[model samples]
Target: MDPVYHIPALLNETIQGLAIKPDGVYVDVTFGGGGHSRAILTQMSAAGRNGSGKLYSFDQDADSLRNKIDDNRWHFVHSNFRYLSQWMDYYGEQQIDGLLADLGVSFHHFDEAERGFSFRFDGPLDMRMNQQAGRTAAEIVNTYDEEALARVLYIYGELKNSRAIARKLISARQQRPIDTTGRLAELLSGQKKELTCVFQALRIEVNDELGALREMLVTARDLLRPGGRIAILTYHSLEDRIVKNFLRAGNIEGTIEKDFYGNILTPFRLIEKGLSAGEEEVNRNPRARSAKLRVAEKIG
Candidate 1:
C-alpha cells in the first residue's frame, strides 16, 4: 500500500529553516508534488516578485514538473538537483539565501505501481528517478556481477544477508531475466524488511542516488550566501549520515581540519541536530516516521 501523495515531511521545520525574507532568493531542490515549493511561495511577499525575491525549484522527474506552481515568482527547472549550483550559475544568479531538499523517493513513485518503487504491485523493474534517463533496475539485477550486486545491497540497503540475496538473484536470472518487480520480489521474498530493503538498494543504484546527493551538497555549500541555511529531510541512515558529516565538518568524511589557531575549519554551523517528525505528523503520514530533519547555516 502506498500513501495518497508525497506529503512534504517536516514541512514547518523545513520552511522555517529557510528563514524566508520578503526580498530574498530561495530554492527547493526536490520539488516533489510542489508541497514544499508552494509553502515557500506562500511565505514570500507579492511585492517581492522579480526584483525583490524569487523561488527556483528543480526536480529530475518530469511527472513532478506538472505540479509546478504557476506564479511569476516561481521558476521550475527540469534537471537533477545535483546540478543545482550549475543551474543557478546558468540563470546568471550568483548566490541564494537558502535551499531546501526533501530527500528519498517521493510518495507518488511508490503509489504508482508501474514505477516499480514498491513490491505491493507488479510492474517493470524500472526504478529510475528520471524515467527517461539512466539504466533501469532490471538491467542491474540481471547484469551486475555477484559481488557488485552484493555490495549495493549491503551498503545502500544495509542488508546483512546481502550475499545470500545476491546469490539468489544471480541464480534466478540465469534461468530467465529477473525483469519485473513481482519476479524480483518473489525471488528475494522472506521477511517484509528484506523485501523493502532489496527494492530500496536497487532503486538507489539504478538512480545513483547517493552520488547525486553528495554532488548536490557540495554544490550547495558553494552556492549559499554567508548566513544562508540548508534544511534537509532524510529518510535513511545512509542519507542522514552523509548530511550530518557534510553540515558539521564540510565534507562527507566529517573530518574537522584545524586552522592556524586550532579553529575547526568548516563551511557551516549546525542550526538544529536531527529532529524527528513529531508523533502527530508521523500518525498522519507513515512515511514521516523515518524522516529526520537537519539544518545548518553557512559560516565564515
Candidate 2:
C-alpha cells in the first residue's frame, strides 16, 4: 500500500503563510511521502516557474527517494536535515525564502511492519529512520543500563510508568534477548495503552530525533533570508514544546525577553500563534488529532 499520511487541511494555509515568491527558494526539510512537498511545488510553480525556483528537500530515509517526483526545481538531499547548512553550502545557496518542516512520521514507516516503527506490528524492533544507521531500538532496549533506559523512557516517552517499564524490560531480557518488536511489546504487556509511549521512547532514543530536530531548527534559522518564514508541524508535546519556545523566544527555554523599549528580541517574529487541526479535518484523519502547526518569520 502507498503510505497513507493524513494531509492536514492547513496545508494551503501554512504554505500561503510562507508567502512564497515565484522566483524565490524554499526548503522542505522532511519530505515524507512528498505530501507537503507536492503542495509547496504547486504553489511555487503556479506562475510557471520554469524550474528557476528551487526546493531543497531532505530525508535520511532512502525509501523516501522512491516516492520522489521528477522535477528540476527540487533537489533531494539524501541526508539528515541536521546537515541543512552544509547541504545548502554545497548547493551554493546562501539563504532561502522559506522553510517548511512537517515533523510527522510517515504512514509508510508505521504500515510497513517490517520497519518496526509501530507497536501494532510484530517486526524486529528496528526504528532507525535510516536503516544504514547504527543501532536499532532492540539494541537500545536490550543493551542500555537500567538507569539510562529509564531516562529514555521518562524523557522521550513521558511515561509515568517509565521506571516500571524499564525494570520489567531489563528483567525480562535476562531470560532471553528481547529481539523483536513483538517480544518487547509482550514483555511489557501490562503497559497496554502505555505501549505506544514505550515504543515512542525507544524510537526517539534510537534515532536521536530530538537532538536532530534541535540542530535542524538552529540551522534553519541561520539559513533563512531576512524576512523568510518557517512553518513547522509537530505531533507531540516534546517536539511541539521545542518548536513553540524556539519560534516565540528564539530559545528552547521560554526565558528570553524583549528589550527595554518592548521590542521583541527573537530572531524569529511570530506570524501567528499555534494552530491545530479543525474538527472536520481531525475527524477525517485521527492521526492529526495531536498536530500543532506554528509559523514564524525570520526578522533581520
Candidate 3:
C-alpha cells in the first residue's frame, strides 16, 4: 500500500509545542497520514542525538494502518484517542511526557469518495472514521427525528437554518431513504451553507466527535506528568472552542476553580495564544486556513 498523506497543518509549530525530550514518552492521538508522528519519531530517534524514546500513535481509521511506522521506538494503537488512558495503561504507562492531537476529519477522509465525508462525491452517506464500528451518516439522515437532526446541525455545525434544513430532510426521506451523499447535497444545492452544515452535522453526529474530544482532552490531561505538554490542532471553531476551554478551565464545561494559593485550579497552563497556519501553508493547503493550533503544559 502506498503512503497515505495528510499535509499536517502547522507541522513545525506542533513539534515545537510538544517540546519533545529525549528518553521521554509521547502520544500522537490523531496519527492521520502519520506526518506529525513521523516528525516526532525523527526527533526522538537515538541517531538524532536524542536519547532513545517511545512514541505511541492512535487512530481508529483502518486506512491509516497502511502508514504504520515499523521502528522499535514507536507503537500504533487501533482505537479512538478518547480511550487514550485505557490504552496507555495497557502498555504499562501511567503517565506520558507529551501528547498531540489533530482534531476533526483528515484529508484522506475528504479525498476518498466512498467514505462519504465530502459532499462533492457521490457515495453512500457513510462517514464512520472507524468504519468497522458504529452507525453511518445515512442512518441519521434517514431515521433521526427532525428535531434531533436540527439540534445536531445547530450545535455541531453552528448553522442557523438547521430547523428548516431538518424539515426538508424529513420530508424527502419520507418518500425514500436519504441513501447517498450526492442526493443529500443535491437537495441542498441552492443553499451552499446549508449543504456544508448538513454534511458537517451528520459527520459529527455519526462520529460523536465532540464527545470523543472531551473524553480525549480530560484523559490526556490526567495521563500527562506535571510539566508535560499537549498540542491540539482543530479544523473547525466548534472543536477549537472546546480545546481552548478545556485547556483554560481544566474541564469540558469550562468552569474555573482556584486552589488555596489563589492560583487557577486548571490542570494545565496555556503555553501560548491561539494560532493558525501561516500564509504559505494555507496557500499550499487551503484546508489549513481553518486550522487552529493550541498548546499547553500540565500544571504543577
Candidate 4:
C-alpha cells in the first residue's frame, strides 16, 4: 500500500462501527490508498470464511488503480461512487452489508503539486479528480460570472467574503487568465484560513464533490440491507451536514416524517453522530483533525 497516498481517518472506529460479517458484502466507495478497504479486508478474512466474503472498492481517479488490492475477494471498480447502484447491479449485488466512504482529499492529491488541489503549491489550476475529463479550476475561475463564482465560494467554502473574493478573481483574470495555482494564490492571498477556504471552494467546484456525495449517499441508503451499516468520514461542514441529515432522516432534505400514530419515520438508526478522531490518531495524522465520522444502520 502507498503510505503517502492517504491515511484513513478514524480507521478503527469506522471498522468497528461497520461490524463486518464473515460472509457479507461490503463497499468502500472512497478507496484512496486502500487503508480503510484493507482494514475491512482484514476483518473479513479474520473470520476465516474462505472467499465467501466480497468487497467492492470504487474510485473515479485512475491514479487509485495503483493501490488496487490483489485478493480474489476484493474487486476494484474504476468508476465514481455516484454510480454505486449501477455498478452494484452490474455485479449482480442487490444489497450490501456495509458501505464506507471517506470524503477527505487524498494526501497524494494535496502533496502532488501538479494536481492543483492545494494552494500551498505552484502548479496549473487543474483540480479535477478524474484528470481525463470535466472542467478544470482554471476554467471556472476564468469563465464563471462574478455571482456564480461567489456562490460557489460562499456555498461550498462557507467563505464570508465570497463576493469580494469573486470580484477580485474576476478583476485579476481580466488582466490575464488565472491559469495556474500560483497566480490564483497570489491574487487571492490573505489569511491562511481564507486561502484554505478559497482553494477548497475551487476544488469542490471543479469536482462537483457535493453533488456526487449526495448521489452516493442516496444510493448507499437504498443498497444497504436491514441492519446493514453505512459509515462516512466527511472533511468539511457542507458534506458533513448532508451526511448527518441524510442519516438522521433517511433522506437528503432531512425532513422528519411521522406516521399516523405520531411516530417518526426513518429508515436508519444513527450509530455514530459526528464522531471525530481521537487525539492519539490526530497527533499522528493532522488531516484527521477535520474529519467527522457518521455511521447509521438501516432499519427494517
TM-score of each: 0.96, 0.95, 0.95, 0.97
Where does the lowest 10-residue lDDT sum fall in candidate 1? 44-53
Query: Which candidate tops TM-score?
Result: 4
Tell me how far candidate 1 lies from the true structure as C-alpha RMSD in angstroms.
Answer: 1.8
Off by over 4 Å in 1: 1-3, 46-51
State in Å the error of residue 62, model 2.
Answer: 0.5
Question: Which lDDT value does model 4 have at 260?
Answer: 100
RMSD of each: 1.8, 1.7, 1.9, 1.5
Q: What is the TM-score (0 to 1) of candidate 4? A: 0.97
For candidate 2, give the lDDT. Answer: 0.84
TM-score of 1: 0.96
- Residues 133-211, candidate 1: write the lDDT tens digits: 9999999999999999999999999999899989999999999999888898788765689998898888889989889
Can you write out model 3's per-residue Cα lDDT over 166-258, one digit (the tens) per residue? 999999998989899899988886477777777888898999998999999989888899999999998788888899888999888999898
Tell me the whole-model lDDT of each prediction, alpha carbons only: 0.88, 0.84, 0.88, 0.91
Ranking by TM-score: 4, 1, 3, 2
How many clashing pairs per prediction, in order? 0, 0, 0, 0
How much is 88 displaced in model 2, in angstroms? Answer: 0.6
